[model samples]
Target chain A: MPGHGAAYFGKLAFGLVVMFAILAGLQAAPRRSRKIIIAFFTFLGGLYFALEFFYPAPSGENFLTGYQPLVAGLGAVIGSFAIGLGVFSLVQLHLRTLSRLRPGWGYSIVLLVSFVAMTVFGLMNEYSPNATVIPTVGGLWQSQNAHGMFRFLFSGGLSNLGSATFSIIAFYIASAAYRAFRLRSIEATLLMAAALIVMVGSVSFGTALTAGIHPKLTDGSENPWANLRIENIAQWLLMEVNTPAQRGILFGLTLGLLATSLRYWLSLERGAYFDKEL
Target chain B: MQHASENWWVSGLVVLLSLIIIGKVLSAQRGRVPFIRRIPGLNAIDEAVGRATEMGRPVMMVPGISGLDVVTLQALSIFSYVARAVARFGNKSIMATIDPIVTGVAEETLRDAYADAGRPELFEEGDVRYLTGQQFAFATGVAGILIREKVAASFLFGAFYAESLIFAEVGQQVGAIQVAGTTQTNQIPFLIAACDYVVIGDEFYAASAYLSRDPTLLGSIVGQDYCKLLLLGIILIGIISTSLLTLIHGGPVAHLLHTLVDFLKVK
Candidate 1:
C-alpha cells in the first residue's frame, strides 16, 4: 500500500476489516477445531523457516529466502503496536486506582503525570519544527520549542533516575557477595577465593604488585617464571577455567533452546499454556 | 578449518534435533514416558506458595522484563503452575510484567489456572499488572510491590539484567522466600546468593516439565539430554583426533577429518 493517499486509507480499512473477520471466524469456530487451526498455521510458519534455512539450494538462495526481513519486520511491526496496548493497560490500571483512592493512589498520580509528560514531550521533540539539535541546530523551521522540556524530562529526569537505580545495584552486589562469599562451605570458600582473584586481577594495584614479574626476559626470550604472577594466574584462571565452565553451560543451554523451539514450532508442546483448553 | 555460519551443519543438526524431540513426543503418547530428574527450584515453588497461604500474603511472580519471547513464555508457563497451586490454596497471586502482551497472556493463564483449580472466584483483575517497559522503572515498581504487599514468596523467572539483584535484595528485606530461574548465566550467581532456591542451566527451560510432570514434556527433556550426549561424543572424538593428528603432522586421514569438521560447521 502507498504510505499516504486515498488508496492507503482504503487498503488500511480493508486490512482492518479482514483481520477482524478472521478473528471473529476463529472465535466462532468449535473449540477442538480451533486447536487444529492453530496447529496448522504454526506448522506452516515453521515449515517456511525450516526449508528456507535447511535447503542447500544450488542457486545459493532458497525460494523462500528473500522474505526473511519482511517476516522479521512483521514481528517488529506487531511489537510496536503492542506498546500501545501496554500503555492502555497502564493508563487503565492507574486511572482505576486513582478513582478508587487506593492506598498507593498518590503513586498512581505520579505515574500518570510522568506517562503523559514523557509521551507529549517525546512526540513534540521528534516532530516539532523548532526541535533543533543542540550543537548542529539545523532544520527546515525553527518555530516554538518543546525541545527544552523533552530534554529535561528524558535526560535530566528519566535517564538520571535510571542511572540512580542502576547505581543501587553496586550496593546490592556488595550485600549479595557478602552473603555468597561467607566462609561457611568449601564451595563458598572456593568461590570467594576465585572472586577475590578476579577482582584483584582487574585492578591497577594488582598489576603494580606483580610488575616485577616480567613476561619476557632481558634478551626477549620467554620467562616461564612469570606464569606465577598474580595477574597472569588470574588471566589463566579466567581463560582456562572460567571459559570452559561457561562453554559447558552454554552447550546445554543451546541444545535445550533448540529442543524447546522444535516443540513450539511443531505445536507438540504440552503442559500449562500450550495444553490449556482455549 | 571453516566458519560455522557458512555451511549446512546447523540445518542438519536442527533437523536431527527436531526428529529426536518429535520422536520422543510421539513415543510418549504411545505409553512410554521418561522420568524427570529432581529440580529443587521447582519443588521450592510449592513451599513458597504454601508459605504465602499460611502467612495470609499474596504470591508474587515476575515473568521477566522482556517482551513475549520464548524465555518469557517459559516463565509464564512456570507461572501457570504456580498460579494453579496458589488457586488451590486460595491465596492471591500477583504477576508484574514489563510487556503488555505478557500481562494479557499471564492474566488469561492465571484465570485458566484458577478455573482449573475450581477457584474461579479467586482470580482478581488487579492482580496481573503491566509495569513500565523501561528496565529500572519496572524494577523499582516491582520492589515497591514487594515492600507494600509484604508478599510471603517471590518467583522471578525470565530474562533478567541488573535489576535481578534488586528483586532478590528487596525480597530478602521483606523476608519473602525467593525462587529465581533464568537462562542468563551471568544473573545466576546473584540469584543464587539471594534466592532461597535458584534454578540454573537447562533446568530453567525444563521448569514446566518438572512442574506438570507431563509425559510428552518429560520425553522431550530426555531427548534433549540424549542430544547433548551426542554432542559430547562428537566433541570428544574431535578433541582426541585433533591431538593425535598434531603429532602425526600430515596425513590423508587428518585432512579428511578436518574437511568433515569444516563441512559439518553449518553456515
Candidate 2:
C-alpha cells in the first residue's frame, strides 16, 4: 500500500519524460521527416476509428471498442495540453506588446491583468473549501471570500461582458439583413415577401388575419382548406421548400465531407501539407 | 451486432464509393489530368492577395471556430496557397484560429508556404495566432485584428456557425476584399450577403484542389462528380418507377418499386 503511491508517481514521471522526449525528437526532425511522421500517425489514428465503426463485433465488444475509452482519454489529455499552449501563446503575445509599448499596449496590460485575475480567482474557487468556517469581509460586503469573488467575477463580470458582446449581433443582423433584403431583383423581392410572410405568420396578427378561413367537410372533419391560411402557407414554405433546399445542401456537404475525409485518411490530399516530399 | 447486420448495405456503399475515389486518384496520378471547372472564389484568391499587396496591408485568414477537422484542414490547405502568395508579394498575412491545434498546424503551413516562396526568413511567428477558444471571444478577437490591423483582404474558410456573419460584416466594414467559403448551409447566406466572393456547398472542399491544380485532387473532384451522377441516376430511377407504379395503381411495377425502395433503405 505504501509503494502504490510511489509506483503511480513513477509511472506518471515516466510518461511525462517519454512524451517530452518524443516532442523533442519531433522538433529536431527535418521538415520532410516530420511531415511523414505526421501523415503516418494521421493514417493510423484515422484507420482505428474507421475499423471501429465498420467492423462488426459480437456484442460490440472488440479490441478497438475496448480501447475507445483509452483513446478518448488520450484526446482529453492532448486537449488539456492544447489549452495550456493557447494560454501560453496569449500571454507571450500580450507581454511582447506591453514590453514594446505598442499602440494598444494599454489594452494589452488590461488583458493580462484580467487574465491573471480570472485564472487566480478561478483556481482559488475550485480549491477552496465549501464550508464557511472562515468568513472574511471586504469593505461593505459580508463575505464567503473566495467563492464570492469567483461568483462575482464569473456571473457579474464575465457573463455580462459575454452577453454584451453577443448583443452586438443584433445590430450586425440588422445591417446584414437590410443589405440582404434590398429589392435589387425579382428573386430578392420574392425572398423579402417570403420573409415577411414567415415573420408575420409566426405572430398572432397573421393567424388572426386568416381566422375566418374555416371550411366544412361532409364527414364533419376539420377544414381541409385550412392549408390556405397564412400560417399554413408559411409552414408549407418552411417544411416543403426550405427543408428540401437545406436537405439538398446537406447532401452535398455530406458527400464533400466523405471525399475530404477519404483524401486525408489516404494521404492523397494535395496541399502544402501533403504535396511536400517525404 | 444485429444492427450491424441490418446496416451492412450502408457500409457496402461507403466502401464502394471509397474504392471509386481511390481508383480515380490512382488513375490521375498515372498522368491523366481531369478537367475541372473554374471555381470563381478560388480564382479570386490571387486577386484578393494582390489587392492586399497593392494596398500595403496584411491579409487576414480565419479558419472558423471548428477544431482540427477535415474542413479546418482544407481551410489550412487554402491558407497555405494564400500565404505563399502573400510571401511572394512581400505582403504580410495573418491566420487566426480558435483551436490551438489548428494554430500549430497553421503556423507550420505558413512556415512551409514561406519556405516554398524562398522567403523562410519572412515568416512571422506573431502572425498566426490562437485567439480564444470561446466562440464570441474568438469572433471579437478576430474582429479587433481586422479593424486594428486594417487588413486589405479577408479569407473566411471552413466550418462556421453564428460568428460567420460577424466576421464577414466586420471585414465588410473594414473595406477588405472578402472571399469566404464554408460547407455550413445555414451560414452560406450570411457569407454571400457580406463577402465579395462566396464559395458555396462542396466548392469549399474543391478549393485546395482548385488552388493547387494538382492532378490527384482534380481527379478526386471528378470522382466526386461521378458519384453525384450515380446518385442522380438512382434518384431518377426511383422517381420514374414510383411514378409508373402510381399511374398503374398497384401491379407488377409496384412490386418492382417496392424491391428498389427496400434495396436502398437502411436497416
Candidate 3:
C-alpha cells in the first residue's frame, strides 16, 4: 500500500481532475444541453430531499438519512465557494468606486480597509492558540495576540456598529407607528386602541392602572370572570384575535408556497429564467 | 421527525394538491388563461417603472436577505419583469442582494431581461450587487443606496425579517414609489404601513403570474385557489364538528372530530 501522504495526494489529484473535467464538459456543451442537464440534476436533487422527508422507515432511518451528513458537507463546501464569490463582488464594486474616485469614494476606501483588516484578523483568530494556551500579559495588555485583535475588531467594532445600525430601527419604527396610528379612519383608531392596550399591558404601569379598579377580596378564590385587567385583555387579544388572523395569513402563505414549489418541480415556471435561451 | 407512516395523510394531501396544480398548468398551456383578480401591488410595478423612467432616476429592487430559496426565486422572477420594464424605458435598475448565489442568478436574470428588451448593452455588471451576507449589514447597505441614489421607485419582495421596516420606512422617507411584498406575515404590517402598495399573503407568490400574465402561472394560481377552497371546507367542517361535539357533549360527531383531528395531527 502507498504511504498515507501519497494516498492523500492521489485522492486530491483525482478530485481536481474530475472537477476540471466536469467544468470543461459543461463549458463545451450546447446551451440547450446545459439547460437539460441542469433541469435533470435539479429534479434529482429535489426528489432526493422530498423522498428523504416523506419516506417511511421502520427504524426511523432511510437511505437518504444515512447520507444526510455527506449532503450537508457538500452544501457547506458550495456555501464556502459562494462566499468567495460574494467577497469578489464586494471587492470589485469598491475597487471600481475607488478607481473612479466617485463622490463617496472615501467610504469605499474605508470599507475595503475594514474588509481586509477583519478578514486577516478573523483568519488569525481561527488558527491561533486558545486563550488558555497563550500566556496572559500583565495589566491591560493581557490579550495582545491575534485572537485579541479579532475580538476587538469583531466584538468592539463590527458588532457595535451593527448594533448602532439596528438602533436606527427604533426611530424608524416610531415614525412608522406614528404615521400608521394616525386617527384618520376607524381602522386606524381600532389599531391604535389595540396598540395602546398591548403597550400598556406589557409594563408595570399597566398593573398599577388596574390595581385601583379591582376591589380587594378577602377570599383567596380567583375570579374567573375578571377580564378587566389590561394584561389579561392583552393576552386574550393576542391569543384569540391576533392568532386567528395570523393563522388565516399562514394558510394562504402555505398554499402559495405549495403552488410555487409545484410549478418549479414540474418545470412549469416560465419566465426569463426558464423560457429564455441561455 | 414523523416519517411517512406517521404523517401519511399530509403527504397524500400534498401529492393530491400538486397533481391538481400540474393538471391546471397543463390546461393553461392549451391556451386557456384563467381569470385572476386585479392585484394592485403587481399592477403598480409598471407605474413604478414608468415613474422612474420619467424622472430619469434608477429603480431599486431588493430580494430580501434570504439565501436561495423559493421566495428568493419568486422575487427574482418579478425582478426579471421589472428589469425588462426598466430596460424598455431606458431606465437603470439596481438589485441589491444579500446572498452571492442570489446575486449570480439575479445578474443572469437581469441580463436576460435586457436582452429580451433588445437593449443588452444597457445591462451593467455593477448594477446587480451582493451587498453583504450579514442581515443588518445588508439592510444598512441597501438603506445607503436608497438615500444616495434617490431612487424614484423601490421594490421589496421575498423573505424579510426585522429589516423590512427599515427598507420601507427609508423608502417612504425618500418619497419613492414603493411596492413591497413578502411571504413573512410578521413584516406584512410594516410594509403596508410604509409602502405605497403592499401585496399581502399569497399575493406575493402570485406576483410573477400577475406581472407576467403567463397562462401557466395563472392556471397554477387558479389551482392554488382551489386548494385554498378545499382547505376552507376542511376548516369549516372542523369548526362545525367541534361545536356540535361541545353542544351535544359526546356522540358520533365527537368521534368523527377526534378522528379528523388525529388524522391531521403532525405526530
Candidate 4:
C-alpha cells in the first residue's frame, strides 16, 4: 500500500478529476438529465452530515478514523458551494439589471455598490494584517490604527448596531404583552397568568416584593419558601415544570428532525422537497 | 468509514428512492390524491397577505439571521409561497436577511413568485434586501423596516436566537399582525410574547405541507412522526436498561447495558 500522504494526495486528485468531469457532463446534458443530476447532488449533499452523525459507526478492532469525517467535510463544502453558486447567480442577475438600466435599477446600483464596498473592505482587511489607520473623528470609530480600524468596523460599529436593534424588542415586548395578555378567555387567562408569574419571577424587584411574605410553617433559613425569593421560584419553575416540558418538545423536535432528515436521505420526502414536473 | 458503498452506493440509493417517490407523486397527481388537512397557522397566510393589500401597506418577512442552512431554506420556501400571494394581491413584501446567500435566495424566490403570478412588473428587487450578517444588524434593520414601512403583517420564520425578540417586538411595535415560527426553543418564548400566531419547533417544518395540502408531503410528515416514535422507544429502552443494570447484580446483561450506555455517551 502507498504511504498515507501519497494515498491522500492521490485520492484528492482523483476526486477533483471526477468533479470536473461531472461538471463538464452536467453542462453538456439535456435539461431533464441536468435536473436529475442536480437533485441527486442535492440529496447527497443534504444528508451526508446527518448520516455521519446519527448513524453509529461500525464497531471493529481497528477504527476507520479519517474517511467518514473527510467525506462529511467534503459533502459540507460542496453543499456550501452550491449555495454560494445560487448567491452568485442572484448577484449576477441584479448586476445585469443595473447594466441594462432597468426601471428602479438605482436600487440595484446601491446594492452592487454596497456589496462591492463591503467585499473590498473585508478582503483588504483580511489580507493586510499590519496596515495602519489614522484617527479621524467620532469617539465611536476615530482610531486610525489597523487594530483600531478592525475593532471599529467589526466590534464597535457592527456590534453596537446589532445590539441597538435588538434592544428595541424590549419596548415591543411590553406593547405586545399589553395587547395579548388581556383576560379574554380561560385559556388566555391561564396563559397570561403564567406569563405574569414568569416575567415577575425573572425581575429583581419581584423578589423584593415577595421577600417579606413569611412561610406559613417555618422560620429557619432552611425553609424552602421563607426567603420568598422570586428568582428561586423562577428557577424552580424552570427546573421542575419548564425543563421537562421543554425536554418533551425537544424530544418531539429531535424525532421530527431525524424523520425529516431520514426521508430526505432515503429520498422519500415529497411535496415541497420534490419539484412537480411542469 | 469511506467505502465505495458510503460514497456512491448510498448516494445512488438516496437518489433512486427520491426519484421513485417523485415519480409516484407525479403519476398520482392525475387522480384524487387524498386531501391533507390544512394547518391553522398556514391558513393565516391569505389573510395576512390580504390584510396588507387592503391596508395598502407592506408585509414584512424576516427569514431569521441564520445562514443558508436547511432551516433557512425551509423559511425561504414559505417566503416564496407568501410572496406569490402578495404579488397576486398587488401588495408589497419586504424581506430582510442577515446572510447574503439567503438574501440572494429570498430575492430570487420573490422575483420568481412575482413572475409566476404574471406580475413580474410589480416586483422590486431591493424589496428583498440584505441587512448586515451580524445578528443584531439584521434584527435592527428588520425593526426599522417594520416601523418605517408600517407593515400590516409580519412573517418572522427561520432559525433565530436572542434576536427573535427584537424582530418580533419590532413587528409588535408597528402594530402589525405577526406570524412567527422557528426551531429555536430559546427564542420561542420571545416569539410567543410578541407574535400573533406562532409555529414552534416541527410545526415550522409542517407549514408548507399544511398550506399546500399535498398528500405526499403529509405522508412524509407522518413518516417523520413514526421516526420520532422510534427515537422515543430507543430513549426509553436505553434509560430502562441502564437503570436496571445499575440496580441489579453484576452479570453479562449488566455489562452489556453498561457498554451500550457508555458508547452512547459523548465526552
Please give the CA lDDT of all the candidate structures: 0.84, 0.84, 0.85, 0.69
lDDT of 3 at B39: 92
Q: Which of the numbered candidates is closest to the native, going by highest lDDT?
A: 3
Model 1 chain A: lowest-lDDT 10 consecutive positions: A129-138
Which digits, one per residue and each the tens of the lDDT, describe model 1 over residues A144-248? Answer: 457887878889998899999999999999999899999999999999998888889889998788888889999999999899888888998899998888788
- Candidate 1 vs candidate 2, TM-score winner: 2
Tens-place lDDT digits, model 2, residues A27-127: 99998898889899989989888888777776755656778788888777677767777778878988999999988888798889888878877777766
* Tens digit of per-residue lDDT, candidate 1, span B35-55: 887998899888899999999
Best by DockQ: 3
Relative to the real complex, the DockQ score for model 4 comes to 0.26
Ranking by lDDT: 3, 2, 1, 4
Docking quality level of the chain pair in candidate 4: acceptable
The DockQ-based order of candidates, best leading, equals: 3, 2, 1, 4
Give the TM-score comparing model 1 with the true structure, all chains together. 0.90
lDDT of 3 at B203: 88
Candidates 1 and 3 compared: the better one by TM-score is 3
Ranking by TM-score: 2, 3, 1, 4
Deviating ranges (above 4 Å) for candidate 3: A1-17, A128-143, A212-225, A276-278, B250-257, B264-266
Candidate 1: C-alpha lDDT: 0.84
Give the TM-score of each candidate.
Answer: 0.90, 0.92, 0.91, 0.71
